[model samples]
Target: MVSYTGAVTPGGPAQTRQAGCLTITKLAVDPKMSNNAYLLQCTETDELVLIDAAYDAPTLLSLIGDRSLTAVVTTHQHWDHHRALAEVVAATGATVVAGEPDAASITEQTGVAVDRTVTHGDRIAVGTCDLTVIALAGHTPGSIALFWAGSDGQGHLFTGDSLFPGGVGNTFGDAAAFESLITEVSRKIFDVYADDVWFYPGHGGDSTLGAERPHLAEWLERGW
Candidate 1:
């Protein structure tokens, strides 16, 4: 089994956990930046897709090893998230997937065109597994999250700088942006997913809907 440590951050050490069938390996590409890059693999087929190629292309490639990297899904077009995108794609020839609205910007920043422009509710197939795209705009005009329903009947959400453990991601002090983030998260994520649904954010640690559900009112009251 591929060991998955809990989310890695600048100050925290790595820890491991096991999720059946679906193997999620979280790598802190750059500690100073606290940028996270995830490798989501279908254990049965060994087909994998990388989420956010933050930094260290060589290291990320090494982690992928002999497994075929079918795709590279950019949760958003932020430079910090795709710094190593070009290099990784060059090395692995993985198809680049980006949000439709952000596709042009992603290509502009990384110099690699997006092969697939995914929108909210679009499904991306990876071997035997599938990822449902959920547009969670706020941090950016085209920010998105990918929902993977595991064979065990559990759900895993990859929220790219949109939703986090403590509160929603930073909106640069924009009240409307914050409102949009909270509203979309509540409706698209919290409302649809069950309590046990675990979410892997763009940076820092992982969280569950159940854990963050009770704190919604507090989050709103605190205003991020």
Candidate 2:
């Protein structure tokens, strides 16, 4: 719904209907790249997980404080994806995680060491909700996605920039790599997520896993 309450408190707009189970807030950051960053909060346990800190130190800090954040997770190492990670990590004392290749870049940029370098089949447990990591590198060397499987049963994905709604991401720059990435994303979408799963891209509004699946044929036919 992308609801916005007041612009003063900082962070994303928050809504809590049922208590202590699920709290999801989607934040928007200027990311220095093409997309915006997101912050996910599990309010019941006071456990927070941020996906890409694309803003500055103060703004990120304000958002973290506003949400009672617990940890930070990056989908990739694009400048847009991690512009403010170091600052947030320093302020919150949160553990930062990224794909293995992105680990070095994140460290180089943020100056905050990455505590976890994940690969395919890795999982990040947040209270009862679990985020399973899947390598979907095409947009960059260490591009990845996080699949959230929880009681909601909706199945959510954080697809960095490899895949979007009706259209996939650009592949002209790194055609081979980008093609491989979209293929990987297609495979994951084909296997792990159900038709109803929600796909939250790195830059746009949300779409469904099922909704985008049929378009894969078109993507492939276009030489993806």
Candidate 3:
């Protein structure tokens, strides 16, 4: 079990960590966009779930070589987050899952239908391990985060564009949207989870809830 820093760069090798009974692999894809795609494999069953097929099919496919890909879970409807979606599904035949609100938009843009539309409290299993869906509506009508409460004290969260290291995801100057995102994050995430929980964002390196919790008030005041 190698140490998981959750640090990766475009074209660089992926970082894999053993979290409880799960094998988590984080890879930064799309050289220019710097998008990230994660592979969550259940160590007990070897069943895997790919979170956001953001880009670089060759790299993603290579990382998934010989493993069973149960499904591809798209965090949101963002174009950057699903660039490799159509291709990956075409190649692997894995089920496609997305937030119900944004599933149609994602299908419209990517030309691949979503097999399952999830909402808050929904659970998607990765073999023996399960990922609980946390809907963070703001960045998009259906932005979401995946929560895995590992047996270990610290849990793991896979936040799409809705939450990040420094602040919440971009709302594009829309105060209402920003409010929705910040409020949802503060209530559904910061309030619910403890500090030790690690969160992997749509892009860039990961951060723990504690590290970003202190900045919530500042983020709301700044209002990006």
lDDT of all the models against the reference? 0.86, 0.70, 0.93
lDDT of 2 by residue, 1-224 (tens): 43432121223443322223545555555533435556676655667778887676676676567555667888887677787877787778778888998889878876778899999999886656678888877777787888876576667777777678776666666678757866787776667679987667777567887887888878776754
* Candidate 3, superposed: residue stretches over 4 Å from native: none
Q: Which of 1 and 2 is ahead in lDDT?
A: 1
* Stretches > 4 Å off in candidate 1: 1-5, 9-20
Indicate the TM-score of model 1: 0.92
Error of 1 at 120 (Å): 0.8
Model 3 lDDT per residue over 1-224, tens place: 55779889999888998788888899998778899899999999999999999998889999999888989999999899998999999989999999999999999999999999999999999999889999999999999899997786669999998888999999999999999999999999999999999999999989999999989999999988
Quote the lDDT for 141 in model 1.
80
lDDT for 40 (candidate 1): 79
**Model 2 TM-score, all chains together:** 0.84
Task: For model 2, name the residue pairs that clash.
Answer: none
Tell me how far candidate 2 lies from the true structure as C-alpha RMSD in angstroms: 3.8
RMSD of each: 2.2, 3.8, 0.9
List, residue by residue over 132-190, the lDDT tens digit for candidate 1.
Answer: 99998888888999998776888889999998998898888899988998999999999
Sorted on lDDT, best first, the list reads: 3, 1, 2
Best by lDDT: 3
Instruction: Give per-candidate clash totals.
Output: 1, 0, 0
Top-TM-score candidate index: 3
Candidate 2: segments with Cα more than 4 A from true spot? 1-20, 31-34, 66-68
